[model samples]
Target: MNPLLAGDRDVVISAATASGKTEAAFLPICSRLAEEPAEGIGVLYISPLKALITDQHRRLESLCEHVGLQITPWHGDVPKSLKTKLRRRPRGILLITPESLESLLIHQMGWLKTAFAPLRYIVIDEFHAFIGSERGCQLLSLLTRLGFLLDKEVPRVALSATLGDLVMVGKCLRPAEAGCEPAVIESAALKSSLKIQLRGYLIPDRPHDEDDNPVDTVQNQIVADLFSILRGKSHLVFANSRRWTEYFAAELADRCAVHALPNEFFPHHGNLAKELREQLEARLLEGRLPTTAVCTMTLELGIDIGSVDSVAQVAAPHSVASLRQRLGRSGRRGEAAVLRLFIKEQEVTADSGAADRLRFHTMRCAALISLLLKKWYEPPLTGLNHFSTLVHQVLAVIGQYGGARADQLHRLLCARGPFQETEPAAFAALLRSMGEDELISQTHDGQLVLGVKGENLVGHYSFFSVFKTPEEYRLEAGGKVLGTVPVDGPLLVDQIIIFAGKRWRIESVDDEKKVITLTKAKGGSPPLFLGDPLLVHDRVRQEMFALFESGECPVYFDAVARDHFEEAVSGFREWELADRPWLVSGANLWVFPWLGDRVVNALAILVTEQGFQAGNDDGILEVRNCSEAAFKQAIKTHLAGPRLTKKDLAARLEGSPIEKYDKWVPKSLRQQSQSGHFFDLEGAYQWLERKTDFLR
Candidate 1:
């Protein structure tokens, strides 16, 4: 606070939940602002979600009351009248999101320049949420642009509960030379006890037949367990996907209704209405109904859902960092942190693949939980090139001043901002590409301005976001809007869909109005929501192997899970996986690198380049028309040569749109950027080199 009050250095507070990180940052800010009040906005607090801003606004009101300062929440949900008032007479702190800030800079730069003239500090809450994402890059550029406008550096403060890589986060908060090294305030380790359990279930595969019932035995078991464990407790059940969240919540509600109990289970995700989501939050906080929210990552952040008794996960988390944060939400008010992990896998058959036989889901969940106990988490890696964000900033800059020279745009966006990796030649080429697409046009005065197409884009409210979101259609039942779901194809009138924790049969569909009328159905499968496959870490895979090698089971497993574990061990021994890493399927060969997705992906590329048809089946690298000896020779040769480049592998993939403006980017640059962000080339290479050593 002293250093921050002096305006000499930035600060980063990495502390546990409910540890007063917010107060530590704002105490100095409020004190300084109280001593010398400003006529305009003094502190800019940026959060990743609007709900977080709303929560913080309520908390800060009382803190700022005595200081004679005000804190205003600004986002799309904020009323226009309130925004107009703030524009006319701005004061104190301004809490906003990155997209809102982008819009403000583009559409209200003149107002913002004057309103934020006395800005002294910038606070980024949930700092872990922004790292390694395009949103983070945009925020960094936005902060730099703001400083450029004010002609002075504004000190920064970052707060997070689960920050794994301090060096990278620090660099993100205060880039080199822009500000002094941040003052890190890392809190002591948590002393509270933690109780964790890994519960596993086996679901048998049955042929799909329309005449058969739609009920699933695995889902039934999960819902039954939830009904028994969380009957009257305030808890949270986190699913990996929204479809599952809706399904599980609806299933639990059905179970409760069977016994004539109140509906205490709710589904929360991004598709739900603001009113509905708020209702759920309020009910959970009230502690009257013994509510439990079966949700996705929407509730993982700090939204003040009150003290939860336990946190249950449907499967292995994408990373240990996320699991730790979810665990932090519980164990409040001097209670032990309680976590229950439920891993469900298909029952293995004679023809089942190695992954299914070994029970990948159970192994992965066990490994992640074990690693968490050791305080080992996935570290932050270098991020994407963010060319899409650069294009966004270009249009934003053009909109800000109406027109600007290409050199000015490059200097402001690339040379000085987070897009420093972009070179001058690439910038020129990108401008040319945009001109060809009529996104930007050159004026007779040698300035660039938004063209007709670009005007239509910049005119739309959604243009402020660099991330791509699909157009959604509203779902209504019994004249009540349940929620909205993103549609990728045509919708039929009789199609059965699951949403808002219930099954619905489509009654009518209106393409023009983007609405679907539905009637309640008995049961149905959850809708498919496609996303990038979760990448497993190499260390996690290694840990899975180690767990199998050991003759002991974790003490936290229940009786059912222990039985499943014994079965998995028996099957593992029968397969003799410890004696060999390669399995021959006729003329083809499958190599178990015992590595992660990235290394396997790299290996697939190397095999393909060597004239072998290669693809990844589960965790193994399968090569067509290749023997074990040939595959080994190719890998050894590649390891002895020069390192692989992003272009070498990215070229193998089809040219799919990976970012918002990827279609606008040149084909070569798009692939290059995607590879740099998505593929772990260096990690893959090092992993293979070690394998080569083992082979020798």
Candidate 2:
């Protein structure tokens, strides 16, 4: 327990969640700061979340006080006075977020070196979050620029409880320049005693002649089941969506009132007021209130709510890694963590037997819990080719410096930033597009300068994020805005809708202006399908396949879930599709490769490239009218190649809009980002190669 220090070299501390890794990381940095007591910022702690910054600040502040040092948390919520204080007297450690850091780099360009002159250590908390996101790429570019500005080799330390691929995570953080050796400190010895239980709710089969409503019955059953769990233990119930969180919270509250139990439990999501979220967090952590808060991904990271008895996931917690994080929240402090997974039964026709339905549910449960027990979390992958982010960052850089020469910009962007591999021609093409769009101008000094449009974009808060967000109209009812809704769809007046757990009717809509007004109503609204595509990792699919093949029942499965798995396996065996690459049963042909979204997409491209018509829905990939011979041939060709070129991969992602600015980016760059190769192309290729056996 010598703190697992990585010395002067860059390092990674990958350990289980709730492990002493956080302390292990900070102890060395704090010890170093205490010994030196630098006048300027000694350490820069970058977290993916604003909440994490606040959480770590409190923890570090106490340690700072113990070591007689200073720590400051700087983000949007941090008072301007505190930032001014830091500017005037920079010292110890500075906890900040990527967005805030981006703002600081832009607004305080003159003070970049002075503000961080003494900065030596850079710790990226939850390094896993940064790996596969545009934000991660943005952070890498920003760090490179900061290093260039300071003209120093800063040691970076990445801390994460879950990492599917440690080498890739390290590579993403490592400087491209040679001689910068980064060490990885992986402590797999830290394990959690988590008892995960997968429970399936059976939906009574409705005959074709009967007027049966599955939604109502399922909703009532879910409410009753949720109440029973709440009655037993203090728990955290996770819903995949904000709307569901609200709906479930209201339903549970109503059920609790009927049962004469205290209705102290509430809902916590992004749309809720900051005060309300903080209050819930305080109550959960203090354990003063025996409550089960329904939440979305907002609660997945950062905010600590002490130890709870159990975690109940309304549906598959999206991914095994996410399930692990949610389950890890419970069972802290030597207590066994309990996770109850409830899967809503989907309607099935006579053609679809109990085995088919059970197969889907059981496989999902097995895959999720298996990965969690194996301690394998998906490492972050690179996102959509972000030429837009590149263009935006370039403009931001120009705005800060007034103007930058072409060579200087190229060196800064390509040699140092995340776009290190981007060619000069591509950069030139981007500049031409920007010039066409009037976002940047070539000055008489032969340097790139931000145009008026570029200045406006940089000034806007929305530009801070590289992700695309739909232009949404604020849903207002009774003078309070519930949340934003996509403006792309048509809205009819007087239509009843469910949002934030309340029923409302659209009073009016200004189609041209993209605004909608609403009033309280009972019921009569169509369900809104917000296209929130789940990122299914490649490993999850493999685990799902394993679940189907393996006769062993997972420990997490309840009676219904166990039955479901058994039935699904039987169905696979009956159809002889368990080992088949693709199965054609009637109109629906299911391809069970068990690959993540990216690889599936790649396969889709591969199929299309081989002159086969294909489409995908949900988790299944379909090739229209494909013969078995053609399918086998395509798989063989794909496996025969050493690897697909970046160009070929980009070709597959053509017309796939992942980010907001993606639609506007040149086809080439968009392809690169959408290919999701920022982490490791080799791993993805290997995953594809391994799946070729499934074709048999």
Candidate 3:
């Protein structure tokens, strides 16, 4: 509070979840605002989620009630009546999301300076979520513009739980300030007791000796386990995907019915209706109903879902930082944080590879847990161009000013903002491409205006977001709208499918309405949700290799897991995987780089570019129709050659789009965007040089 009141340095408060970091930021900010009242918005609070902004609005309003401070939550959901009031007289702390802020910058440019001129502090909550993302770049650009508008340095405060490299985060928080020193309050040393358990299950090829059927048996066991372990306790069950969240929640509900128990489980994810999500959050927070939410990363943020007794992960931990944040949700009341991990794998068959036979999922899960305990997290990747976001900002700047000169647009976005990574020649090339694609048009006086296509794009509501979201088909059952799922094709009637945790048979498909009508079905498979696989970190992969070599049994493993562990170790030794990283399968040669996903992706692309049909599955690089000698030569050639540019590698990518505006970008620019954002060529090159020495 003293430092903030002094207002000499920016502050970043890093603490564990539920450790009062929000209050730590607001307490000082509100105190200073009280001492020196500002007519305009006092503090601009930005978060990644609208739900979080709304939640913080309630908390901050109460805290600032006596101070005669106004608190307003701004997002898509907020009624226009409330927004109109803000537009007329924006005062006090305004809680907003980045998308809404972008929209405001576009729609209300005339009032931005007036509404934010007296801004004293800017608070960015959940700061880690924005790091290394296009949204983060958008935010930095927005802040740069705001600073230029007000012509003053706003004392910034960032609140986060799982931030690594404070120096990098500080630089990102204030990119406009040269050599900006941030007062960092790190609480990594704050220790909490954690109780974690890893349970493993192997699905049989046929449900003969184990049960009547494999699927039903596994579902019943999972439900029974949930009932026995987490029943009547406020808990969160996190699945890796939305489809799984719905499937598990519905399965749990079905099991409760079979056992004559009340349905205490609910599904929460981004696909669900906002009202349904809010209802579930309200119930969880009220604590009257013993509820458990089978959710995705929606509830992973600091959105006050009340004290969770424990957190259960359905698969391998996404990342050490993610696992740490999820674990922080528990043990908030001074008890040991409880983490229960359930790893499922199919029974090893004659055709199973060494990775499958050795239960790689279990090994990976255990390795991630061990590393997280040791307090090692993945560092942020740097040197991204973020060209897609630059495109969006160009459109936004045009929309904001109605029209602007090309050089002026370049100065506002490229020359003076976070988009400085965009070279001048590249910026000119982008403008020309935009003009060619009818996304922008030039006026007679050499000004840039939104083209017809650009107007049509910026006219839509989704244009405010820089991330790409697929077109979704709404799902309805019993005349109730359950939620939406992204589908790329048509669905026939009477097709049985699983969605939102229940089995449903499609009754009708309204193509024009983009809705699917369904009736309850007895047996069905989970809906196929298309998404990229979770990328494992290099350190975690290395730790997995070490786990195999050490042969130490983790204490958290149950009886079955221990058996699986011993079997995996035996299989690993028999297969000589510990001594040999490469394996021969038929005519194809598989190499285990044992690196992170980005490096593996780069390796696959590089090998494929070199005329070998190469792919990656479960962290192994599979090269086809190539002898060991040719493969070694190819590797040597790549290592000895110059590094591939983003353009060169992107040309070999089969033209896959990575972001929303990527499709609108020129082919050359899109290639650069995809390569720069998604591929770590340098990392892969370095790993190839080191890991291939054994082959030579």
Candidate 4:
């Protein structure tokens, strides 16, 4: 507090959820502003989600009122009247998202100097959410650009509950600010009991469609368990994706109807209408109803949802950090946190794939939970070039100043901003690519300005977001917006679909306007992907190896899970995985490098480049049309070949890091930037080197 309030250094406060992290950041900021009485926009408070800003508005409204300052929320959904009032005056604290801020930077560039003249501190809430993402890089660039309008360096304050590496976080917070390492403040860990259980279900190994209906005996059992335990409690049931969120909530609601009980379950996610999402949030916060919101990561962050009785995960969490965030939603107010994992595995038989035989899914869950219990989550993603974000920033800089020379653009974005990893030649190449794409053009006087295409892009409201927003068709029922779906293919009339936790019959499909009119549907649904999409860290897979090597059986495992794990352990020992990490059956050779997914994906591509068929099955590397001995010899021979570069590895990938601006970027430049973040060729090389038998 002393350093934050009195000094100019940046600060990062990491603490458990419901432990006053928000207050810790705002208390000092509010005090400093109230005491000094700054003129305009005293604090630049930023959040990752618009819902979070709305929640903060309610929480901080009274405090700002007491301190004789104004607090305003700004976003796309925000009322124009409030935005107009703020624009006219621009005083006190302004809560905004990265997109809206981008909007102001482009649309209202003229008013910013007057509005931000008195800004003192910049606060980023939920700092972990924006640390390593494309949005994170955009936020950093926006802040760096905002710095250009101010007279002095504005100290940044970060608040988070699930940060793994303080050093990495500090570097991200101040990428170009030398000697501006953030002062790390972590709360003392509280001693509490954790009651957890892991239950496993066996899915029948029958033929299934990729987009099949999410209804079966295994799913029903998991929902039945949820209905029995969480019927009359305020808790959060987290699914891996929105599709499963809808499926689980609808199933749980149907069960309540069957028993003549009040429907306490609801689905909450970003796709749902604002009114519907807010209603569920209010019900949970007020505690009037015993509501259990089955949701995606929408309800994962800290939003003052009151005391949750427990947290339930439908499948394996995408990452340890996400698991940590979801778990933090519970175990608050000095109560032991309760957790249940509904791990589902296909019944193992003779024809099971390598992933299922290795029981990779269940072992992944166990390893993640073990890592969480040990207070270790993944560190920030390393080696991100963010070429797409650079493209957005380039256009933004051009628009912010109306026109800028190429050298100035490069200096600000490449030299001084978060995209320092991009080389000068690469940056120059990007500018040329943008010109060819018609995103930007150079004037005769040596100034880069928006072209006709760039003008149309910067003119749209959607241009503010750096992440990819799929083209979605709105689902409307009786003139009310339900949700949206990204149907990549054509949709005909009289189609039955599931969305927003309910079944819907497609009444009409207007391709021109991109809207799907719907009516109340009686039954049936087509489920989407439910498996984890994030890459598994090397430490997690290594920890899974330790779990298999040791003979300790945790008490939290159910009988089914225990049997599944025991079988996996026996198979692991029989296969000699600890020593060899490879297995051969007939024509296939499976190599378990225990390397992270990024490296493994690169390895697959490199192996494919060597004229062999290789791909990643879960975390295992599978090579086709090769015996074990042949595969080993091939890898050794490749290691003795010419050294591979990121460019070479990236050239093989069809698509990587598909951000919004990636399509407009040149192929060579896109590959250069994508490779920095997506493919770890050096790691793949090192793994092959370690595994190759040099003595032979």
Q: TM-score for all predictions?
A: 0.87, 0.84, 0.87, 0.90
Candidate 1 per-residue C-alpha lDDT over 409-441 given as tens digits, one digit per residue, 9 for 90 to 100: 888887778887788888888888888989999
Q: What would the per-residue lDDT of candidate 2 be over residues 1-696, giving only the tens digit for each residue?
A: 233243467888877666666788889778877777777888899988777787777767788899988889988888999988988888888898888888888889777689798887899888877775667778887888788888887888998777767777777786466565468788866344667677776666554332222343576787788887666457888988887899999988888788787886689988888779878887888887687889987777746678788888887655766776677678887888787888755545555422244456557767877887777777755433457568767876787677898788888877777776677888888888887777888988798887778878888987776765456667776676677775422233543455664556678765345456788754222222123345567777778777777768876677877777677777767766665556764543456556665555455555666676443333455565566666777768866765567576566432333455554467667656555542234454565566666556
How much is 34 displaced in model 3, in angstroms? Answer: 0.9
In model 2, pairs of residues that clash are 132-381, 383-673, 384-673, 384-674, 385-673, 385-674, 468-660, 496-525, 538-596
> Candidate 1: minimum summed lDDT over ten consecutive residues — where?
523-532
lDDT of 1 at 618: 46
Best by lDDT: 4
Candidate 3 regions with alpha-carbon error over 4 angstroms: 176-178, 189-191, 206-217, 471-530, 577-579, 625-627, 637-645
Q: Give me the candidate number with maximum TM-score.
A: 4
Residue-level lDDT of model 4, residues 1-696, one tens digit each, is 486787488888998878888888888788988899888898989999888899999999998999999999999899999999998888999999999999898878779878998888899999999987779999998888898866467889999998898888899898886666888898868438888899988887665564354445698889988999887788999986788999999999999999999899999998999999999988988987799999988988988888789999988775888888888888787889888899988777665657787677788888898888898879998557788888899998898889999889877776777888888888888889889989999999999999989999988888899987545668899998876776532232443455654556567767558677898854222211111236778888888889988946668999998988888898888888888867876566777888677777678777766676565666677666667767767776777888777777666443322467876777777666656654568888888777656315
Model 4 residue 424 CA deviation (Å) reads: 1.6
RMSD, one per candidate, in order: 7.3, 7.2, 7.1, 7.4
lDDT of each: 0.78, 0.69, 0.78, 0.80
Model 2, position 579: C-alpha lDDT score: 51
lDDT of 3 by residue, 21-121 (tens): 99888887788888899998988999999999888987788888878788889998999998889888888889999888888888877688889988888
lDDT of 2: 0.69
- After TM-score superposition, the amount by which residue 563's alpha carbon in candidate 2 deviates from its true location, in angstroms, is 2.1
- Candidate 1 stretches with Cα past 4 Å from truth are 176-180, 207-216, 470-530, 567-581, 585-588, 617-619, 637-644, 693-696
